[model samples]
Target: MSDLITVEIPLGERSYNVVIGPEALMTVSPLVAEMMQRGRAIIVTDEIVAQHHLAGVKTLLTAQGLTVETITMPPGETSKSFAGLEGVVSRLLDLNVDRNETIIALGGGVIGDLAGFAAAVTKRGVNFIQIPTTLLSQVDSSVGGKTGINTGHGKNFVGAFHQPRMVVADLGLLTTLPDRELLSGYAEIVKAALIDDARLFDSLEKIGVQVFDSRALSQAIAAAVAFKARIVAEDEQERGRRALLNLGHTFGHAFEAEAPKDVIRHGEAVAAGMALAFEYSVQLGVCPAEDAARVIAHLDDIGLPSEAGKLAHTQWDARRLVARMRDDKKNQDGRITLILARGIGNAYIETNVDEEDLVAFLETKLK
Candidate 1:
């Protein structure tokens, strides 16, 4: 095990620590013990993660004299929906969980979102801990308090900014993830660098495929987490600069909405969406064409989905994807909001984007 890295999200009253490294799960028991009032905790996870890490977590908490209950759901994007939220909340209520108790999210992004949202609304609100077992969850979903289930209209359209009391990202758990999953998560890491960290982007470009190497992986995760912590602290409610974090999400979510469940993972969509964002920026003369090409080349080299037409299992329509973007939460006054880059490591929020122009650009990509 390597030395653990702790990144602080300084949100004053809501501030918390995100601990990352191999075997960081060891920190969870003591942290949960401190938050226990009734000495009870509920673990919400998907079946896939439960099979691998659930029993060990239960043993750790029970050793500390805490009563632990678990709610396990199916594994996949479909589980992040109204039905999933209802099932978790209902189970927690049935177990008589109280505000003083804690809810632990123990899986990837889907489990984190579902369980975190459950913690937000149940008993009006309760403290929860994030034990993210996947690379995507460890670097992205687990650190931020943004939690919610998906609606038929779009992804994350119904969610809240409920920060976790603690986030334990055990890198050892990531060793079990498939290569495709690792690649998917790496897209977000690239996104953070593209948003405002040119140095980080440069490092990523040099490291390239070696990012999966342990030391490199740890360093990348720490840098990405630190970047997000700073942005989130400044704009917890996303009133300003924080919107930069959604560099690829607006286009990503639309891809997700049009695709069938589990056909495309969130990170895969973001990878393609990011490529499109840069390409669109180039078309609008806002970003250099060379920068857009570089972004696409990096994504393709990483085996990620870098173009909408290249995304497997779904045939995309430019008009339908544009319609989905209209429902994005970031939009205001019926004008679409997009994150565009002027260059690598320079992304900004662009509002009132011309829909006709967007459709035309997407049409080109489809062809």
Candidate 2:
């Protein structure tokens, strides 16, 4: 028997299920049918995913009598753009994708964010299902209601809080992921563990990067999703506890925006960002220096970048990077909101980040 797990995001009426496992994709059609009685679906995927899973997705939905149409975009971070959003919106309109029908985001985080934002704005909003293929999307982006695109200013700078009707994360699909991409996804699982679950972090340390083993992978994914499910249920709009999910994101996003687009992927930046967050916490006299070192060592053991200097195509400019963080959505009244840690598995939101201190910390990392 296959190991299948489902985590429910208890959001009253807007609540949904994150179904994980090898057979998770099979559940998408029925879930979409329940959400959209018309049995119509327009799949939004990238060219790469289309080559791999688009046909199977069509077959699944078609078996359920759902009329399926697909729109393919070029794969990469560049696809998360105003132009990409506009293109998706236009295609849905052309296909007569009414509000009652559904949009299935059938790729990684990029597809989920772009397609989800399209579903949010089109005809005022439409039902959508998330079929996140990559491990990063599976454990993090797909579960949250965060849907957005990037602008020249920064990553995920433009977007919405629209949740999906269902999230189908087929772990089997991850078997085909490139090793680099797979490690990138592992960074999110590590983030989740560091944010709230010390036990999880301990298990990961013991397991090393062999987390791809069937039992280990399933457990890690379930644990990560469960952690996120609880946080999202408590603070759907990122009002409080939810912000903890962005522990490394604030610094990570700044670096990501400054680095070359095609280079460091989101999770890679996050790995570096997380290390920076821990190191910065030590500088703030918050997290223990030993804790920060432990976290960095684990990330390095897994082949993830633990330092900003290691990132490719990065300009390593502290001032410009800090400028990018100023545009982060978490900021309020010009104060940078950061997710810091007291130690491993104990992250919190700190809104009053001192700019001078932050710049100094970044300066050390730049060179």
State the lDDT at 273 in candidate 1: 91
lDDT of 2 by residue, 79-178 (tens): 8999999999999999887777767899999999999999999999998889899999999998879999987776787888999988888877787799
- Per-model TM values vs. the true structure: 0.96, 0.95
Clashing pairs in 1: none
Clashes (N, CA, C under 3 Å) per candidate: 0, 0
Candidate 2 lDDT score at position 263: 81
TM-score of 2: 0.95
Which pairs of residues clash in candidate 2, taking residues 3 or more apart in a chain or in different chains?
none
Please report how far candidate 1 places residue 125 from its true position, in Å: 0.8
Runs of candidate 2 exceeding 4 Å displacement: 27-29, 33-36
lDDT of 1 by residue, 1-367 (tens): 3478888989999899888887777765677777877887688998899898888888888888988888999998778999999999999999988887878899999999999999999999988999898898888998878999887676787889899999988888887788888988998999999998989988998889998887788889999999999999888888888889988898898888788767887889999999999999999999999999989988988789888877875588989989989998888889999999999999999986999999998998988
